[model samples]
Target chain A: MRLITLPILMLSMFSVSTFAEEHVVSQKNKSFSENKISINVGDTVHFLNKDPFFHNIFSLSDEQYFDLGSYPKDESRSVVFDTPGEIEVECAIHSKMFLLIEVKKSEDN
Target chain B: MKTLLFYFTLLVSQLSYAAETEPTDYTFIAGHPSLQQWLLPTPIPTPKDNPLTAEKVSLGKMLFFDPRLSGDNNMSCATCHNPMLGWSDNLTVARGYKSKALTRATPLIINLAYNNLQMWDGRIKTLEEQALAPMEAELEMHADLSQKIALLSGIDGYVTAFDNAFPDQGVNTKTMAMAIASFERTLISNNSRFDTWVKGDKSALTADEISGFKLFVDPVKGNCAVCHSPPNFTDDGFHNIGLASFGHDNPDLGRYNQRRLNLMKGAFKTPTLRDIALSAPFFHDGSAQTLSDVVEHYSEGGKVKTNLSPNFTANTLTPEEIASIVSFLNALTSPHKPFTLPTLPQ
Candidate 1:
């Protein structure tokens, strides 16, 4: 019973190592699903436009900067947080739509 | 097998009952509970740093109407934001310092207290930041900041008013901006025929006006309610609603100047539609001459469609329907109040 449990734990650890963290932030009703989120460096955050209208995602942050141009409903864009810092994400069209992302250093690094 | 059949029968009956309860008439649409979201909030939201006070309001009112705040000492904020003309100058485009014709129209100061951003392009984030802009701008008031502050500091009447408004802070740019913003916060409009109708008065709107409202909300119809939302009638969002001026050689970049995004190239902040009828020659460029002209432009899905907002579409509204929408817009104006001009301090 001990041998079987040890192998199961090792396999789960391997699986976790192979997959990088990915988060989905949906835009609906001119707002983000989450106002803020935390993730490790190299983790990807996907912005999904769920509203009928177009939404543009961009960040003029210190560590990471990106401008995902406007896209219509059902479309999505992803950005990888390369640095460990706070990034303010906002929709260009809708000024009120704002999200803050806290990126931490990867433990493996 | 017998239990399965019984459950299926129950489900079918429930579905039919639900179908029966679904809204099917105009009465249900007109009196929907969701309509209550359109009511304006009271007691007005103010920043914690600059809470509203009678002293601040009075001081701000004097500064707003005082021409001595300018470089030439002839033009005040009231020169362009005339209270009689919907708090705007009612010009095709604003006349700035030395009677220079500006590129944009003088936007009404009405209900600006509720706005998240200021100016047509939304460059300024707060009213405090906005109050000092025209005075400092070369084309507007053209006042030197230090000189203006010095002038205010020397005046005993202004110094006393500033002391009363800011208490410990005394006379300075920051306190002056806060006081002006506090006064501007008082400029709000919550009373209108449409407001009364929203507040449970069935007789407030005519049948034609009600139909126009339906058209305004309908996705396939006028679709005005998409941007001009409830209460304040502004979504506080920016859009490049294709205007004819956008086709010009050197068209204004608007929000693009601030954000540097292609989508925001010609985008301008969506202004409040409350009392919109009074502030005519609409659009950021002051292109449309009248309200009908504005409706007509939207009906065409915008003449210059390049880079047009995805939200806009060719509205298939008839002449009568257009007139009805105009009639509904007319009901947005609140009853006028006799505005007494503030006495300038010597």
Candidate 2:
């Protein structure tokens, strides 16, 4: 059957290039066990600091603004969430840490 | 005095050190309160999700001295911050909103509770995002924050001060910039006379302001505590002291426009000489209009050296040590309260 329809169209383009959207964003009880979230638009989000001290995530928000400039303690950083709406992220050396991502909209035609 | 305001709020909540280097000098001694050996802790930048109240600091001091939040009700925010001139606006440029001038000038909200960043090109890092950068700038105070919150939600005395100030997240623009940033976080400064001579009070200052506070902590004389440090003088950091004298011609990379690094070219924000002899024509383009021309532009270390700020040029004082570091920076100025003005909500 034509080699099983070309191996089911190459396994649907390898499951849309292994889609992503991860999270952890902690700095130890400084809040953000998901202050707000939603992802899909080429997903990717990871901040993991889990306090022992050292963090700086930063954002000027209008839909994604970066400034990771200093991270230490169980290290991590990804951020692909490709713009959509309602961002509001933070850390800038812990002014009480914060979060809010929500990307959505990318179900492939 | 309540055991000296409980040892000065346990010296500004344990300015505990070891965040590495940077804590230059001045404060925490005599009846000890732990300015953590001269200030550092800062990290309670309050975001465990924006918490701060007192009916959002009394509706952010009536939207910081209302004037219909500007667009020609004739400016407010104490018309360029004027808690009797210590909140700065002694002007060197600032005017606009049709009065016209602005190249930069008008800063001083007092000890921004330990500044991590905000303006003079630190590009807003909260004060509820630096109170909407002078009302949607078109040259300051242009006002249009969603038609000034739909004309202050059709005023009925701002609908009872927005129903006793946010009775559950009311009247928008992020709760009117977190209620004028919770009345600019209680505009804190902590009593001066160099904090009653750092609390020992040996006749609080005057011995040439205690040899200009021992040559402002002599690091080779008036090293001005390596960037106006201690008990909040300012190490809120950012340099490039050279003021590129009034003509400007290129290079204001400051804090490298949010750190692109290049020794933060012609950097800005290092203010806080605390109520700095009443915020007069100083740098960030006010071009040092006198504190002996900003101690002769740091005694000549800034006249432009293409990318200066190696602790900004021309050192080795002596005019009796720049008049004892300008009489110990006029004892770090600050005290002028009595407000009153506001009254527009009708």
lDDT of each residue in B135-219, candidate 1, tens digit only: 8999999999899889889989999999988888988899989999999999888888888887778888898888877777666
**DockQ score for model 1:** 0.21
User: TM-score of every model?
Assistant: 0.88, 0.28
Q: Candidate 2's residue-wise lDDT over B1-346, tens digit each?
A: 4333333332332233224233333343443453333332343345545576676777778878887777886787778887776777788867868789876787777767567677776678878878877876878888888998888888887667767777756687888887787678677666667666665765766777667666666556666665665546665656666666522666456567665544555577777776577777777777777776777667666676766544443566777778867776777664566666546566
Among residues 3 or more apart in sequence or in different chains, the pairs in candidate 1 whose N, CA or C atoms overlap within 3 Å are none
Model 2 stretches astray by more than 4 angstroms? A1-109, B1-53, B58-101, B111-133, B141-143, B146-161, B166-182, B191-193, B202-209, B213-284, B288-293, B297-320, B330-346
Model 2 error, position B146 (Å): 4.2
Error of 2 at A62 (Å): 51
Give the chain A TM-score for each candidate.
0.81, 0.29
> What TM-score should be assigned to candidate 1?
0.88
Best by TM-score: 1
User: What are the clash counts of all predictions, listed in order?
Assistant: 0, 7
Displacement of residue B149 (Cα, Å) in model 2 is 1.3
| Per-candidate RMSD, Å | 8.6, 23.4
